[model samples]
Target: MVLLDGLADEGSETVVKPVRFRIGREGVAESVGVDVGWFTARGYGELEPDGLLRLSPVEALYLTKYGRVAVEDDSGHVMGFEELFSRLAEKTANLWRDYVIYMDLRNRRYVVKEGFSPHLRFRVFERGTYPESAAKYLIIPVYEGDDVVVEELLEYVRACRAMNKTAVVAVVDRRNEIVYYTVSLVNLINP
Candidate 1:
């Protein structure tokens, strides 16, 4: 994947990068070029039955951090952000009566809340549905004048660590005025 320091004013609004290999498939026991140990230590793995790797809805949502839409499977299939949001909204529409999305304009941090106040603290339970295993906050950093403000990012990581949940951060480089994408996973016991 091409990595850029920042995005250009024109071109694609959202970029999708494809993965090269399937996780858990024959001859693909490890995450391709990615550090599998981070994911494995956190209990995430491939869907053996379908030959698909399951990204936490939180991680999937984080792909939008870099103005990217979604991360593709080994097959090069791209799933858009709107589609992901629609699917989640559909699944939990009946259970939750309201939805609140938070985006910090200063830092570009975003969080989605369904049937809960933004101030309430929560923990995610892996292997469950949205709101069940969903990260309380989705943090993204947009390069401001000189440095990156990471308050929200730290908060999310801290929350995930305290709850023994996996924290995945998608880092986008926009230095070249061209958009580039990549993902990073950090296992936090206490951020």
Candidate 2:
């Protein structure tokens, strides 16, 4: 539900600027199609003290593609979902899988963002909370059919533990359904 008009750009990326943009205060950034509530509710962005909603690139792309934000270049050109998405994807390690996990968590009403333990892409704050509290969980995305390295997963748990957050893996199926599991080091001792 976003409106596109008069957005043009010039940059090295050749796609109307780089993956990130220089959205003008009012001249460049249009009133978004989705209200600030849409981003706040999904834990994607925040309305700053200046009344401008600051968003992460991940949130911007996800919302632009699926949620309710529309993006255009500086010259009034409509930016398609795939068009923007492709640009964002170039910056991530596993773009498709990560985005799928991000959207899934957001759709479930949890406030999530991209600041978790290293190697993990998200820090899921408790429900109904947004930027006011510390994150509670760290989530790493993995496909059900993919080979998982247990040692690597253990490291994530250790790092999250040190940071006072729980570590979980979001296992995605072929149908894009997700299931979560905590990764931990199981100490074994003979009785």
- Measured by lDDT, the strongest candidate is 2
Q: Residue 79 lDDT in model 1?
A: 47
Enumerate clash totals for all models, in the order shown.
7, 11
Model 2, 1-191: lDDT tens per residue? 23222222211222222123323343223334334543454465656666666655566666666524566666656567687666555555576777788888877778887764337878898986667888998997888989978888777788888988888889989888889998766679888
After TM-score superposition, the amount by which residue 23's alpha carbon in candidate 2 deviates from its true location, in angstroms, is: 7.2
Task: Show the colliding residue pairs in model 1.
Answer: 4-173, 5-173, 5-174, 5-175, 6-173, 6-174, 6-175
Q: Give each model a TM-score.
A: 0.27, 0.69
Residue range with the least summed lDDT across 10 consecutive positions in model 1: 94-103
Candidate 2: Cα lDDT at 150? 80
